[model samples]
Target: MLLVDFVLLSIIVGLLRKGSLKKIGEIPIRKLELIFLSLIIRYLPLFLKGSLKEYVVQYILVVSFISYGLLLYSLLSNWHLKPLRIVTLGVLLNFLAIIANGGKMPVSLLAVDFAGLGDFKQDLFNPLYPYHVAMMPKTRFKIFGDIFPLPKPYPNPKVFSLGDVLMGIGVFSLIQEAMLKKKSASDKISRRKLKRNL
Candidate 1:
């Protein structure tokens, strides 16, 4: 997805700079984005569960929220705003979701029952557990929004949602926008220099 974003963004930038796609209003709408969003929405309901489901859904949502927030800020901001704002939002959302859903993101203690991770599932369920990476922040997060390969799972593993994919795409788009801006600025500078010399 990131690679695709870069390619699409590069082409768009080239067109805009060359005056082929002359106006911001002329930009094409992203239809395929709707399909992607639908797929993500399918996973959002997992948060209501107490079992491993809730932890997985919430984890995906938080990551997506962060990534999407970053993407939106980069695209909409004047390019002068600090990037940290987007990153901070992502982190805060993740923390809040972790707190709201459970002390950790409700990992399946049962699954880790056999992993010999010293009762990882029990620790994840425990309200008193510290904010260790194994508990809240790390385990339940997405692995590119796919199945997790648990290494002695201490917390829940392999969960994500529609929000995560959206966030990933948004992050991809923002990066594309940044590269486009740089190319635009460079083109403008070259044009100005040429005009001055002429």
Candidate 2:
């Protein structure tokens, strides 16, 4: 939800800067389907919790790693884009944290309480949850976990990780670049026409 907010904000900012919406389509993002496939693989286990729940749980880590690999590969395919490089770095940070913690993201209990989601504590601790685990003394790479709290009065408060922040910034920058680049090109053409008329 917070990420969605970031995207909306980016679009709003771009429009305010006199950027054209059509310019976003000009971005040379390659292999976009891999990102969707990665997401599908990551969440597929969540919906298969009836007949193959046990099997899914047992192999969830493998599934996660594979999904991350696909996502990374797709992101790397657009490595020439500076904003995407930052986004890829953020994803790499998350990948390292998950791998270090035995395939589950560690969530800080304190952060959950701060975010007014205390009710979710039990789910965080549940072994079958398959996505997040409660942060503890034994949790590895604690710095990379979801420890930052975004408390209420905000629209969609939630606990987020450092990597999430980086990704948001990267996305915002990407949109800005697309918007401004288009505007600058148009301005140059207009100036050339004015010089010709003069």
Candidate 3:
């Protein structure tokens, strides 16, 4: 959800900067299918938990590692893009944190409470959750966990990590670059056409 907000904000900023949505299609992102596939696999357990809870939980760690690997591979394939490199760094941070924390993201209880989502504390601590674990004194990679809070007055209150913040910035920059590039190209074409007509 926070990511959605980041994208929306980026698009709005791009439009304000006289950038066109048409240029988004011009961004040369590779292995787009792998990105989608990784997300689907990462969240598959959540959807199947009703009936296949045990099965999903049993292999959740393997599935998570595989999904993260796929995502990292896809991002690495586009390393030529500066913004994507930043995004790759962000993903790497998250991957390390998850791997160190036993295949689950550690969530700060203080951040959750600060975000006014205390009700979800139990879920975060639940062994069956298969995604997040409550941050504890012994939690590894605690610095990379979801320690930041987005309090109310912001449409959606939630907790996020440093990696998430970096990813958002990278995404914003990517959109801005695409939008400006399109505008520059169009201007060049118009100037060429004008000179030919004169």
In angstroms, how far off is 152's CA in candidate 3?
0.8
RMSD of each: 14.1, 3.6, 2.7
Model 2, span 101-181: residue lDDT tens: 877889999999999988779988787777888999999999999999998898777898888888888888998898778
Query: How would the candidate models be sorted by lDDT, starting from the highest?
Result: 3, 2, 1
Query: 96, model 1: CA deviation in Å?
Result: 6.2
Candidate 3 TM-score to native: 0.90
| lDDT (10s digit) by residue, model 3, range 172-194 | 89988988773478889999999
Off by over 4 Å in 3: 183-198
Error of 3 at 42 (Å): 0.7
Index of the highest-TM-score prediction: 3
Work out the TM-score per prediction: 0.30, 0.88, 0.90
lDDT of 1 by residue, 25-92 (tens): 33333343543453354334434455555455445545444444444443344234334234334434
Off by over 4 Å in 2: 183-198
Best of the two (1, 2) by TM-score: 2
